[model samples]
Target: MSELGIHYRRGPATVTGSPRPRQGPHAGDRLPDTPAGLQRRVAGPGYHLLFGGPTRSWPQDPPLGGRGDLVSVHHLGTQSPWPGITHALVRPDGYVGYLARGTDLTGLRAYLDRWLPAR
Candidate 1:
């Protein structure tokens, strides 16, 4: 799983309702081993803005804090397939719609606008 680098903030606990399976993380892959940690939660309906990084790491982005739909996972840099990138906007259905390699908030916003323009 480490090679795949597909870290799930929420995912399946077991295969088809079976008992919790054991998992071991390889070097630098800080994946959780507990059942609850593996369980994939059903994504809530609607557009959910997700960002990966340490909380309070970007103080300049003040508007980011006001969005109630935003989700933050601090370990994204190490867990995501796109390492060294700062932000990713995931669709509500759980696919990466946009990824920015640096602190380019404007690019991120433009990408979002392209998909969903002002209404």
Candidate 2:
């Protein structure tokens, strides 16, 4: 079974259940076999996980942390209301998923200069 779960934060339109089983990152994909691997996938370029609006699932993981261009939401330790908000790929339902702060990939690409370069 999938180890993922929707994080229930204190807010309206709360995340209900695990995202209906889809393609890509499955339960046992094993992409993030280690911390560094996770780091790469989360912050890798050409990828941004967006939530809300018509689009449901993100085709790719979000970007990682940054100082000037890419603002690391996780690093900031805060939360912003969603509409076009995205975040770093730190596991869909991991502990950080429930955290108040993290990265937003859509914002990163739109504002930041970071781009997903093939690795």
Candidate 3:
């Protein structure tokens, strides 16, 4: 599997337990393993926000700041597994909760508010 593109998504399972053709990273799909150091960093509690490359600007207050302990951020430089993707939010369960191909974080903020609303 490692030989395949990191963005590859397994086909979804059908009601009869057969796999259905699909594409792209969907919510609940298991995140492919990142580099060892990054994997270790996210092995604990909290949702992890991974930046694929150097960002020009980032929010002064990250989403879900009220639950800071439950959120952490990491920069993967150019070695990010998700080629062409700018950001990837991995949930605590090791699934991809969100993904962004551009620098705009509006969608990311909305996703956080909907799922991990700040208290």
Candidate 4:
């Protein structure tokens, strides 16, 4: 934000102890997908999942309400926003909640589980 000339309250007086800001994707950032591709991926109401690398498989949907409300998985190729990441869970709000550089479904599950209850 600072680099973009958007400034906010700075220094120790600002609220502290929050988790470090992640760089994968911001709340309002665009999904790194073509219009048609994104249309196909997020055809329903849910997350727009993207995975890099040669993996065609995705983890089983977690305990969310329905597949449509959980995630719409897609295979991201070389055009991936985060080149090294194997998987990323883009929330409906457009923020990337989780990203994995390797095939770690368990870790991804844990990360998503931590946020599901809050949602």
RMSD of each: 11.8, 13.3, 7.5, 7.2
- The residue-by-residue lDDT of candidate 1 on 41-104, one tens digit each, is 3155544343445544544443443343453333343444433435555555455454444554
| Order of models, best TM-score first | 3, 4, 1, 2
Models ranked on lDDT: 3, 4, 1, 2
In TM-score terms, candidate 1 sits at 0.46
Q: Least lDDT summed over 10 consecutive residues: which range in candidate 1?
A: 12-21
Best by TM-score: 3
**lDDT, candidate 4, at 83:** 47
**What does candidate 4's lDDT look like per residue over 1-119, in tens digits?**
43323322242212111232234433234454443365446556677667765654444453333444466777766556554546666666544555556665665555555655434
lDDT of candidate 2 over 1-119, digit per residue (tens): 54343333333212212322222223222223232344443454332232332233333334433432322223211221222222332233232222112233343343233333223
**Model 1 misplacement above 4 A:** 1-42, 59-85
lDDT of each: 0.40, 0.30, 0.61, 0.51
Count clashes in each candidate, considering only residues at least 3 apart in sequence or on different chains: 6, 9, 0, 0
Residue 87 lDDT in candidate 1 = 55
User: Model 2: clashing residue pairs?
Assistant: 43-63, 43-64, 45-116, 46-116, 73-102, 74-102, 74-103, 86-104, 87-103
**Sliding window of 10 residues with minimal summed lDDT for model 4:** 11-20
Runs in model 3 deviating more than 4 A are: 1-27, 55-65
Better of 3 and 4 by TM-score: 3
